[model samples]
Target: MNAISPVAHPAPSDEIDLIALVQSLWRQRLLIGLVTLLTGVLAAAYAFIVTPEYQVQSVLRPALIKDLDGLNRTGVYKLTPAQAMQRVGAALDSYERRLEFFRANQGLFEALREPGRSLEQTFESFNRDAFKMLQPDPKKTDNLSAFVGIQLTYPADINGVALVNGLVEFALASERERIAADLATLVKNRLHHLDLQIAAARASYDASKEAKIAALLEADSLKRAKLQDELKALRQQLRTRRDNRVAQLDEAIRIAKSLGIGKPTTPSALGEGERASQGSVIRTEVNNQQIPLYFMGSEALEAERNALLQRRSDDFTEPRIAEIAKELQLLAQNRQVEVLNKRENEDLFLKDLATWREEAARLRNLQFEVAGLKLVSVDQVAVDPLKPIKPKRALILALGLVLGGMLGVFIALLRNMARRIPKTANSAY
Candidate 1:
């Protein structure tokens, strides 16, 4: 026969192995039940003995338009509803503010103290673990309005509702006070800036007025000097003309004495009478040359010369002399300069005075009362929860049964495998 090849035998199917495993588990059913019962007991003990924590949430939304109307009307702080919500939210999230509340209301958090921890550390732990800030998801489409909430999980013995509500109130009050203070400070600073501007504008106006006065005075002085110069030239011209006339009169008197002629006789007058007597149409000569001044008689010329020499002032001779004297009198005092110098309130003329005053008045008259100014709306106030949130007994018992069954099955399979391994080794030897 050919070398006895080992007869090929197929391995057991998965179904057969599964049945055997079920049978093995059934054989250790009492042990499995005992382990499961032990686990269930432990779970029950933990579920009943653990301290239950109750959850309380205080919800907040943006204040109504009417509620914030006072602040909006003030115009100093132009806060929108969204901005108001953000302010309250920021105040709620501030750790320093929370600590301040904690310090002030130490009695409220006394029950939260843990052994071996300082008061601050205990409060820190409580703040970190027990408190949660709830906000809407920004990516979601339905989250239109800005809402925020403070959630607190505390032991059943603690007044969680009161605590959470107080926290929310504290945050709102703190934010309101901060807004008021900021508005006051901003108004004060603005007023100071406006005062400085008014002062500067007044100084500038005064300086410009002074400059204008000086310019007017200088122009007046120059004009007066020019008028005086014109008057002097006119007076000199008049004096020289009078002197020439006097000299011409003297020459004319001498000529008349030598020619044996006197008493205002012109050359035309002497010859025109002779031509008329001849009766030949009496033709007289006309020429561009002016008549000589010496034609007047010596007595008349002498009398005019004496009057000119005795004249004290030639101003009456020149019409411009009166005008110059009047202008000089007017220059003695500038009416515009007088008005500017006597002005008492110069700020009224500033370009921005009305605007600055209106703004400052608005700031000063703003309503800063935190009690009336609603910064946020309480959408949901904290209320005592009907049941604890932690130590879910039903879920714990179900989990315990499942886990215990798995553990029992694992132990049974291991024991069976160990016994089979020893038998297999004995048979091989």
Candidate 2:
């Protein structure tokens, strides 16, 4: 058997290595102890000294409001829930944009700029991240909402409560603009559609009325003309033949009388039409000619339709349209409000667009006005900055210790492996 040299040992695994490991470690135990003790103390010092950040919380509660349309009071929405939420969420993002409005706006920033403390510096000092929340210490949660959150955060030195309140107001204003803009779009679209329907109805109604009146007047004029022609022809023949002439006149007179008029003792046209002009007749060689005219609705029927259309009888009929149109004599007095509204729908088709655009502009203005904003307290003073939130220090220290111990145990296992040696002569040094 060859004598083994310690430094030349074969791959260390076959021989039991416990005693060697104990001896080796005992030789370096002081170094190992020192390293462990220093590591532990360093960890303890780390827990003690690193700036303990205490998080102050402010919550952002989503606002609930009447529907955007304002017409739909009940929550059953025509828009999908996802869409509504998205639209509202977009508006909220716009509101968040205002966070930069007050402080970041050039004018405000310039105004805030001081020789020693610039706007940038002031901003750095005045505002802070709005939340560093305690992990759900079940004690912090209430039953009303699933949300366990605090949206606002500030440094322990900053005014937390006041800051929270300020953010709330900004959030409210943001919500209002969003609702208004979205609602305006829906309302404008609905109004435009209704306007179109009313216009079409009015056009058809008037056209039908004019046509009926034309037919009735034409009939009345023809009836009057025939009677006149018969009377004139019989009269002409009467001069040539006396006794027969008298009989002919009598027959002619009877015919004229049948049309709700007396014979021409005074010789006037029969009132057989809606208008006097419609009853005009011309005597031709063979007979009389009459032109038909448009028919008018009954007073009651016209009145009812007018009311439904928000039209005045005087507007379409003879009297009122003339009187009121004096102020606006140049414009077509015949145009109805419903018709104008229809044109807005048909020609411009911008009702919804204009509405939403205006709302967006209005919101944009508000957002700008709210820029460079600082959240100050609404009703109360900021609590002392010295009161830092509890940081769960003990828990942190415990985690550090466990991790350090694990590392130590792993090193010991590696040390034990290094002590193993093979039993064969070939493995000897």
Can you give the lDDT of residue 423 in candidate 2?
36
lDDT of 1 by residue, 153-264 (tens): 8998788888888888888888878887887887788889988987888789878888898998899889988988988898999889888877877787787666555666
The reply for model 1, stretches above 4 Å from the true place, is 1-24, 141-145, 268-291, 347-362, 417-429
- lDDT value, residue 363 of candidate 1: 65
The residue-by-residue lDDT of candidate 2 on 1-429, one tens digit each, is: 999875754454555567776677676565566656666676777767754445444333222333233323422224433344343334333434434544544442343345787655565543444333222355655523312223443434444555544444545455445555655565556556656755666576556656755655566556556645654555444433444434444444444445433322212223334455557767433325432111111232334334534532222333433443442342323344434435434423433545544544443333222232222212222343464454445765666666656566556657655543233444554
TM-score of model number 1: 0.84
Model 2 regions more than 4 Å off: 1-16, 23-28, 53-165, 180-217, 236-392, 399-429
Candidate of highest lDDT = 1
